[model samples]
Target: MRKNLAGVRNRLLQVVALYAPGGDSTRVRLHRLRGVEIGEDTWIGFDTLIEPSYPHRVVIGRRVAVGMRVLILAHFAHHGRNRESSEGTMDDRVSVRIEDDAFIGPGVMIMPNVTIGAGAVVAAGSVVTRSVAPLTMVQGNPAKPIARCGIPLGLDTPIKEFYRRLTPIEPPAE
Candidate 1:
């Protein structure tokens, strides 16, 4: 009982944090939600929206960074057999899972039934229609593989270490 209550409280807090006044401009709007998990230390930028039509349709992992103007949709409008009578309704619904440490760039669109693998980087302005491999970089309209992470180029350094090496140069004593 306590766990259930905690879960509800967490969900409510998330909704408030995301949709509250003066909070994030990017908000998650849904018709129905169930078992949707957003991990810790994730940053969702402005103008982003996530709408899940069905229950348990969206799951975002930890340390995931979503850029501005990103859209994550979990339902689509499908037309019936009769084209004339079918006006296309939101019937086909699927789940979308963004794994841990994933970086989704600005203006990116993630469709339903897609899993963004762990540590994957989706470039800015890309439309992702399929699953991305782990630790890979994908770009372009359809989001193709551009590069792989953990490649040996002597440039592999922890983010903290890289930042720690930076030094501010002082002006010459004038």
Candidate 2:
């Protein structure tokens, strides 16, 4: 009964956090209560979905910005390799980590077993399947690195400086 109650409560909190009345703070607070390891000053935008089954497996670092309609998953259900979950489901446990100063653009979907390194940028509508290197910018279906960054594009950084600091990824030699 206790375990079931906890699961119910967690789902309730998740539902509230999804459409939480206030700003980032409210959503962050609610998610924290639901067991997501969120760092200080991180902003979670409207309708962002963290891992529903195992919120504790998702970690967001300080000053990270998760944009609207983003989906971050921390568990995968592969039939052959799946492990039994406490919730009576079968899944493979994987952590989705976003390091400090990372920017996840709107409509992005981050799959399990991947980390977004510090200062990395994931462009809008990208689908991230692998780990991103620190200070890199990525885009597209599998999120290929487009450029390396000198600094994170935070609220305080100037847009011009952000663009100026980007070094494009050199094409491979033929």
Candidate 3:
């Protein structure tokens, strides 16, 4: 009964957070009460969905910006084929941490066990499957590194510096 009541309360808070004003501190507070560890001055945009089942697994660092419609999932099914049946798929839970000063763009989906490094910028609509490096800019499905903003570690070229650098697709010359 206690667990069920907590779940209901958490759901209500989520609804309130969705409807609450963007600048309202109450919205942030509600999420905190729901067990999401959001740091000071972090801006969680409208419709942002943090892991509801494991809210405590999500840790948002100071000044991080989670854009509208962003989905941070702390749990996923190991087996994709049989999603409905509990026996078919095993549910795995892992913590997700958005480091300080990181920027998660709108509609982004961050999978479990991912850590958005400090000052990293995730482009809109990105699907992050793994951890991102600090001070890097990532985009596209699976979230490949596009550029580095801070001082390079030791790589010769720009592309070489990335953790998983992908060749940019160029447009056909007209």
Top TM-score hit: 2
Q: Give one digit per residue, the lDDT tens place, for model 2 in 15-120.
A: 8998886545899999999999999888998888898878888889999989988999887754543455674433334479899999999999999889999999
Off by over 4 Å in 3: 77-94, 151-174
Off by over 4 Å in 1: 1-35, 78-94, 151-174
What would the per-residue lDDT of candidate 1 be over residues 1-174, giving only the tens digit for each residue? 995775576556445544444311223332123345567556676656665233356778777777877888776743442244243433322368888888888899998778998877788999999899877777888888877755211113466643344333343468
- Tens digit of per-residue lDDT, candidate 3, span 1-174: 998998899888887886577632766788898888888887788887787766777888887878888888887743552365544332323369888878888999999888989878898999999999888888999898877755322212354544454334343569
Model 3 score (lDDT): 0.77
Clashing pairs in 2: none
- TM per candidate: 0.61, 0.89, 0.75
lDDT of each: 0.64, 0.89, 0.77
**Cα misplacement distance, residue 55 of candidate 3 (Å):** 0.4
Looking at candidate 1, what is the lDDT of residue 94? 35
